[model samples]
Target: MSTERRTKVLEVLKTAEVGASLLVKGWVRTKRQNKNVAFIALNDGSTINNLQLVADPNQIAEELLKLVTTGACIAAKGDIVASQGSGQSVEMHVKELEILGEADPEKYPLQPKKHSLEFLREIAYLRPRTNTFGAVYRIRHAMIFAVHKFFNDKEFLNIHTPIITASDAEGAGETFRVTSLDMDNLPKNEEGAIDYKQDFFDKETNLTVSGQLEGELAAMALGQIYTFGPTFRAENSNTTRHLAEFWMIEPEMAFFDADDNADLAEEMLQYLVQYALDNCQDDLKFLHDREVEENKNKKESERPELYLIDRLKFVVDNKFERVTYTDAIDILRNSKPNKKKKFKYLIDAWGADLQSEHERYLVEKHFKKPVILSDYPKDIKAFYMRQNDDGKTVAAMDILFPGIGEIIGGSQREERLDKLEQRMDEMGVPKEELWWYLDTRKFGSAPHSGYGLGFERMILFVTGMTNIRDVIPFPRTPGNAEF
Candidate 1:
């Protein structure tokens, strides 16, 4: 390794130390020239802003200057001086330059132009070099860091659950099988059926849909824990809000009821939003401007009411409206959407499973604030949820954002062995498959609650991004898994 300490472009642009000798290496974002000098915009993936380098014809070799172009990697030894241009604070007056790598202009895909998001998705590998994706990914990193920081500050231990398991956690039967067996010639049993016993794990296994079950086991002992990792699902729907693979943040807390779970979820989300506001200002500002530009083509009624920053502040500064599922149903039933037959699924009575449209109307139109709907019907919720005394509802809660429906979903788990086993039987979850999970309640269980916040959905809301795919770095949707 070379001992030469190189200054990153972000530090140079941010500090703007005048007359300081600096060696900066980065990819050229844009290049412009005049008869007297050449200006190169360089980025090192440190920030959304680029550092400008001014090269004079007389000081630099003519041939070297000719080789500098967009997408080329270069090293510039220069003096950091105040820029003489607009839209930037500092620039480098280069005394020496070297072209580390040359990108052929003819073959380079990401030229300096206005490329559509669809076009950018086709080139996901190179999309990070663009201004929009750079800002998005930077904000994504900030949010991810904020998640661990918030949980740690709250004394929640981070847990890494197994990615492959023999039992499905979500119990939705939507899982990707994880097998290392030969596909062409599978092993057969005495019944002449494909034998999963010959697989790597010696039993049927799949990618985890959620880490909630394992998280609960840890929480029962650790008091509180959280999981932040990749989660997989086999759902085939190709919608803006769906992803075949994604990252999830699930925090489980022992000795906590449904109310406490809702409070923690609200606080954590507010903290994350505030963290982004403080740490990711430049990137968020860029995405905010990008959102404004993209919203131009949208119909007036479909556009967001507030700017990105204001919307974020609104969530952080206000109290989330907490109401029961029954109350929310009443609100939605009397709302104009239901009366006008505008909702795709009309709310006819209690115990009806709420869809995204209904959730949006409750949070955005009726309440005009973030809403936490709780005490959902047990039939619509998971079998692990604690059944209420009413015999029809469960101690579950879903926090819905204005634009994004159900940003967080969780419940106070059933801690009673008899009740849990009965519900599992009712839900068709085989008791034999989850013997270890049932052992928790059988041995030493306490009231526990947790919720899952889809990491990409939070990023989408924070960045004012319309599509969920835009927030995640190589989105995995149906029939599209390109890198």
Candidate 2:
């Protein structure tokens, strides 16, 4: 309870002078007590490593020491001393111990044992106390910081886009509707249609699917802007890749073409990977080992080609392979997988949309590195992508990684008002609803481009976690939102 500033376990482990008295407050990860002495491993979630506190059984009361079990919070003041331990270099000699919170040993689900990820999700509230989730969350924080740092270093302004909006930017037709009207007896017009005008926004509104459209408006004025925020989709997918809600990183820039956009994306991703290697060494090592252990039992063909750390470094050290969609289609069509009838959806046609199998094969087998497949056919892409001179393909690009199909999706936006309207009409994109967006092209639209990176998917790639749910703190999936 002293007024002196508390010392973190990370600081003490990294740089603490021996014989200096300090205080550390954290939950007791494990405690071993014999008649002679007790060794308590305390963690405050500051780092992946825990600080070992050596306490004399006589000095610290039995009542106090007994409560310092796993899942119990404790504050200890002690003197720093050199450790004879294997993993850690320093340990604390505890002079004072206080229990801030106590977890009943009978009811506490987390113990000094391994629990499957499925079991952990059942108790998501206490899952963070586990070693695996702890490392995951720490890396999650690191990625968040690096995202802002990456944009800020490029002099890109961070914009807070609205969470609630009326536009279905992706036109996915699946959204969580926000309303204050009575559902039992809803307001209906003369045509017996539910009148959304009586709702909160006086129009049909739902959680936004993408911030790129609004980010463009700001880019037209601010030159360059980025939005890193939560986005929602109401699809009924229950795969490892689908989430009802997730975070997205969307950056819009003026005077940048599709090539410039691809270059920036590659640089940004590599920078983040290098940043993690430099800063989060301990946590990365833990997750890397975790991945190795997870893949040990699988078939060789199903196993990852490289270790987690090697995979990350390979991505940073090598340049991504750039290939056109037409070229990629040719390769896939003539490749052994398609020829041997191994592909789930065989690459039989040129204009057909590429599935996850096709994308992963291109990255993992065909290129043996990250690949940027560009100039997709206009019919398959969104309406905002710029139409090419050939009139069949758009200036679109998708960055594909080994395990994941497409990590980043973006395009050089259709800046011409006439061309944009024509695409909108062809796709039946309700141009009247996006009149303000049309105004952007009518007034002062410059050659601009942007992309959206799924924050969790990248984290999945970075942490080498298989399930998309594990990377996020509390996953919002189809039927599960429990915390």
Candidate 3:
């Protein structure tokens, strides 16, 4: 049969019509045999839920029955029939089953019980067989599609930025240096500095932390542009939120300011949430139900109280709260929690960068929703951000979700040539290296704004998955790049 002729297990089960001839192929999830009847759960990676397959021992040969083990790939020709079982609404009555591949039940790591996320990470290949990982990855895929759709529908140009770059855009100095050299036989200059002439690129290059710089160049010409690709950072952060490699979505628009940038970020976030909720309800429910079941086994006080469904529903239903950085600082300083002084970092000053803990409190406790904090101190922000009237702060905004601290960070770019030059000089950025960038301002400078949304972070937020490793297919963290 042609590929299109094959029926998806989900489609067959969801339709609920009886006596329809169908051909289904998938890895067998489970198999249970009675005297004459056998039931099997089959999954095709099309959805989180599996399809039920009922086979009669009398009709099918005993040879085929022995081969239908858990994790085995099978192609079954069956009749789509209404299921009388309470577990599912529909099932397939198998006429003949052909085993395409066999999996040794003993070697198969996945069982019909709950497994710790840490344990699952060790066997990344087989982890998707479980319900939670499957749903998370599927939702991740759907969210990617939704993002492309959201931007494409608005006529935003999709720009591809280079993974390897020569300059540090953020200036935080967290970058994975790329080199091709024999460390044992190194070349050095007269001053004992590493010789760049012997390096592959003739100079030091590192993985990009953010695509905003290249994205800005494209936006200047294209009017509206966005970059969606992998970004790397060398920060040795072992926290749940930090990852050495992650995907970032940066959208830049010309003739836009900080407020316009905030509106776009909020709209994009809500759109993705609504899209996933609408398109992947089953997958979301599967993850939710699995989490609830897992949580129930723990002590009442120890159990996770927040519901994924409720959190996502709230995100889609409510308007994101907006506040200036000054306002956020005031609120955090005067709050009862701040008075007790339990947080690690101080939130007493306006110019101080808001730590992750402070951001959590503002979004989770004070706003009770996604909060957009804008207008940050210029010294703490990137050099590209437009300087505000006060000269001390820049027009930068960070959208902090309740569970995920900072989902998006963006700002309005400084367009004035003299101010840009001065900022670069003050930051010690190389003037010769950024000649092309300076020329963009000379040609036709327009006020432009953009933001970078951490893609994996969004998945973590939507799925309520705690670790950054859980959201990505293969996570790359510090000293954990094993494939």
Tell me the TM-score of each prediction against the true structure. Answer: 0.97, 0.97, 0.95
Spell out the clash pairs found in candidate 2. none
lDDT of each: 0.90, 0.91, 0.88
User: How many clashes (backbone atoms < 3 Å, residues ≥3 apart in a chain or on different chains) does model 1 have?
Assistant: 0
**TM-score between candidate 3 and the true structure:** 0.95
Task: Please identify model 1 stretches exceeding 4 Å from their true place.
Answer: 1-3, 296-300
| lDDT score at residue 69, model 3, on the 0-100 scale | 90
Per-residue lDDT of model 1, residues 245-354, tens digit only: 99999999999999899999999999999999999899889888877888899999978898799999999999999999999889989999899999999999998999
For model 3, what is the alpha-carbon lDDT of residue 175? 90
lDDT for predicted candidate 1 compared with the true structure: 0.90
Off by over 4 Å in 2: 2-4, 297-302
lDDT of 2 by residue, 1-483 (tens): 645578998899889998889999988888888899899989888887899999999899999998988999989998998987776788999999988899998889998888899999888898888888998898888999999999999999998898899887567549998788998999999999999888989988889888888899999999999999999998888878778899999999999999999999999999989988888889999989988998899999988779989999999999999999999999999999899999999998889999888888889888999999999999999999999999899999999988877889999999999999999999999998899999999998799999999999999888888889888888899889987
**Could you tally the backbone clashes for each prediction?**
0, 0, 0
Which candidate wins on lDDT? 2
